[model samples]
Target: MRLIKLDATASTNTFLKELAKSGYLDDFTVVWAKNQTRGRGQMDGNWCTEPGKNLTFSVLKKMEGFQLNKHFELNMAVSLAVFRTLDLLKIPRITVKWPNDIMSGSHKICGILIENSIVGISLKSVIIGIGLNVNQSYFPGNPKASSLYNKTGILYDLEELLHSLMQNLEITLSMLQSGQEKVIHREYHSILFRKGVASTFKSGDGSTFNGIILGVGNEGKLRIRLEDDSLAEYDIKEITLLY
Candidate 1:
């Protein structure tokens, strides 16, 4: 694994993708930026991090034997890797929000963005971008954002945390490569946020409803048991969980 550090970039994910096109990047290659001018998140959301105070990096993972249909499994693996890295630090109330948001209690501490390259049904590669709040103590626009320093009152070593994340990521990805799908599935749902708790959700049509998260399906859709006792699956854009 090769690691590159950048003083600043528009987006680490974007930079890593271009590096991969140069035929110089290998599986597990990492690109970390001290500052990202145009950080990104899932969907069209923007990930804002104080320069030099957060972990913003992208990893290039070369897919060899994985099937394209099991891409959600990759999400589960990466999410679990981050969870394990934080768990070693003994972060309390750690939970994985649906589709890979890392939260400490009610506040988000990390976000993951995965971009995959595919040809037909064959898997090619994936660029996994991670944004982790480490030393930042304030969020100007997002009230739900929090950092490790805010939660623990202790500043963490950014390099140390990145090393731990990469180690845990390797173990998790190995599980997926070895076809341990059932184990990955069970562990992911076990730490899922609000798996059985009742919550309110908003649909794309601006309608709100009460539901309980049953877990996620293999295709990465959220499964909810609605008030009418009917179960339904929703895509990422179709619904939003209102905390």
Candidate 2:
């Protein structure tokens, strides 16, 4: 893995994208920033943290002829990779909120945003952007947001964490390529937050409803069993997990 350390950037994913467009890019190349000015989470949500107190990086995953149907699998793979990295740290009550938010109990600790380049049903490459709270002590405006130090009270070496996470990421992505989809699927569902439990959700129309999270659909939609016993699938933007 080629590592590019940056003092700061608007966003690591955007920086890496420009690099790829300018020249040939290697797979698993990483761009890490000490400060990310405009970090974005899932659905354009803003992510901000203390400078040099978090992990703001993007990785390039290049592949040829990757099937379009396998897109959701890639998402599953990335989510599990983050979970594995967090697991080794012994964080308490770790769970993955659907689509891709890594939470420690009720407080969020990390977020993943993946960008893919595709052509005619074949994936070309992807930029997996991760923002993890490592040593930050406080979230000024967002009480629900937290850091590893807050959760564990142990300040971590950012370089060491990045190395371990990259290794796990590489191994997990390779496993997906090696036909280990079923295994990955099981692991991901096992750690899903609120899975198999009654939860409240808000739709795009701002109306709230109750359902049980069965699992994610093959298309990456959240599968919910409604009160009427009818199953419904919803895209990420179509539904929001309120609980």
lDDT of each: 0.92, 0.92
How large an RMSD does model 1 have? 0.9
Model 1 misplacement above 4 A: none
Candidate 2 on 1-243: residue-level lDDT in tens? 999999999999999999999999889999999999998777877788899999999999986788988888888898899899999999998999998889999998999998988888988999999999999997998988998999999999999999999999998899989999999888999999999999999999999999999999878899999999999999888999989
Query: What is candidate 1's local distance difference test score?
Result: 0.92
* TM per prediction: 0.98, 0.98
Best by lDDT: 1
How would you encode candidate 1's per-residue C-alpha lDDT over 15-107 as one tens digit per residue?
Answer: 998888888567899999999999988988888899999999999998865788899999999999999999989888899999899999999
Clashes of each: 0, 0
Against the true structure, candidate 1 reaches a TM-score of 0.98
